[model samples]
Target: MRVFYAVVLLAAVLVLNFSLMHLAPGDVADTISQSMGGADQEILDKIRADYGLDKPFLVQLGHYIGRVLQFDLGHSFFFNQPVTQLILQRLPATLLLVISAQILALVLGVVLGVYSARKPNSIANYFVTFFSLFGYSAPVFWTGILLLIAFSLKIPWFPVAGMRDVTISGGFWIQFWDVARHLVLPMITLSSIFIALYSRLSRATMMETLGADYIRTAKAKGLSNRQVIYKHALKNSLSPVITQAGIQFSAMMSGAVLVEAVFSWPGLGTLAFQSIIARDTPTILGILFFSALVVIVGNLLTDLALRLVDPRVGGRK
Candidate 1:
């Protein structure tokens, strides 16, 4: 049933995206003409005919849907490549940054939240409170710029842009470390806000769970503090955090655009940015479609994870 719903939803998304892009002002021919300084009506008309822009909206949409059904996302107007191929080439970098940031946020958020809940009025709790407030309040781009200045310019701890060092030549581990180093600043920049969010949520849930009847019973049964907290309370508190993580995955993808542009990371975000500037509707739509698919898959995995964490979730469903 879930899979069926996902298919239906994806189709709806495809139609809506296609309609919106069609309605938007200008087309690939306009962008191409502008890039060429100017063009006569004949050249513009030829360009439109070549790209099938002359087709009626419904006809174009039908053709697009047919191509998509065959796993063909169409060609890029600017890159002169298959949309799917371009996306595939850039996907790993985007996935690496987004997933790494998510993991970093979840781990640090859960740990800080648990500790803060355990020591509510302590200095560490206060510190966590301050960090969360700032992280949550700051704009993602602004935070990214700050990190760039402090780490890249002032102290020179990390590279200013790009994913890997072209100058460095070494074995696999050495190359891997170079990439990892480049990843650190962007990952931190992207994860900062999410870490703030998760930490606060975990703290609230953990605090509530600690006061629950089960927790009291566990303590009464002579369970150690670690056993009670880790084994009893923490498990129950994770569902909401996981739910938030799943919901925010799409937002992270969008946010990655700003982060990617700031750091010049060669990801879909950068590709999407370039496509938009070029009015490359096919490439833009392809990115949006792929992003939607990723978000849907992330939500499904979140459901699966929840079912594992608490089988009662599946039972209730």
Candidate 2:
């Protein structure tokens, strides 16, 4: 049943994405002509026909859906490359940003949450609460720009942009840290909101867990305060946090566009930005297709993960 829904949803997404691409202003042929210093009408018409832009919208969409089922994403008009190849090339950089941010956010948020929950009245608790509110509420682009100025410009700790230094030559590990160093700022910007959200959620859920009847029973059995938290409360509190993490993963992917543009990071988001400016319909639709598919699949996996973490969700299974 779930598989059926997933297939139907992806089909609907394909249709809508194709229709909306046509609705966007300026076709690729026009951009091409303008780049050619206002090329003659005959050239423009030939370009359109060559790219199947002259076809009826329904016919084009039908052909597109067929190609998608065959796992072909078409070519990029602007980049002159296969869509799959381009996406594959940029995918690793984006994955590094996304994965790093998730891990950092999860670790920092959970740690801060646990400490705050254990020391409700301490200065550290107040500071964490204040930081979370600020982190979550601020605009991501704004936060990214501020960090770029303070850390990249003034402090000069990390490079301003790009996945790695083209000049850096060494063995694999040396190249690896170069990219990691460049990633630090973007990762922090990408994860700040999630970290803030997770911290507050963990605190709230932990408080409830600590007050539960089972917690009291454990304490009555002579379990220490530390054991009550580590053995009993922490695991249950993490169920909601894990679910939230999955949901945030989708949002973070979409939001990476702004960060990528700001820092000139070479990722899918950067590709999307450049494609839009060039009026590259195929590339734009490709990105939309990927984003929609990822969100749906991510949500499904989140459900499965939540079920594993909390057996109440799985029930008989």
Clashes of 2: 0
Weakest ten-residue segment in model 2 by summed lDDT: 308-317
Alpha-carbon TM-score of each model against the true structure: 0.98, 0.95
Using TM-score, give the best candidate's number. 1
Cα TM-score of candidate 2: 0.95
lDDT of 1: 0.96
**Steric collisions counted per model:** 0, 0
Scored against the true structure, residue 199 in model 2 reaches a CA lDDT of 95
| lDDT by residue (tens digit), candidate 1, 1-317 | 88899999999999999999999999999999999999999999999999999999999999999999999999998999999999999999999999999999999999999999999999999999999999999999899999999999999999999999999989999999999999999999999999999999999999999999999999999999999999999999999999999999998999899999999999999999999999999999999999999999999999999998887887574
What lDDT tens digits, residue by residue, belong to model 2 across residues 84-157? Answer: 78887887787788778888998899889988998999999999999999998998899999999999999999
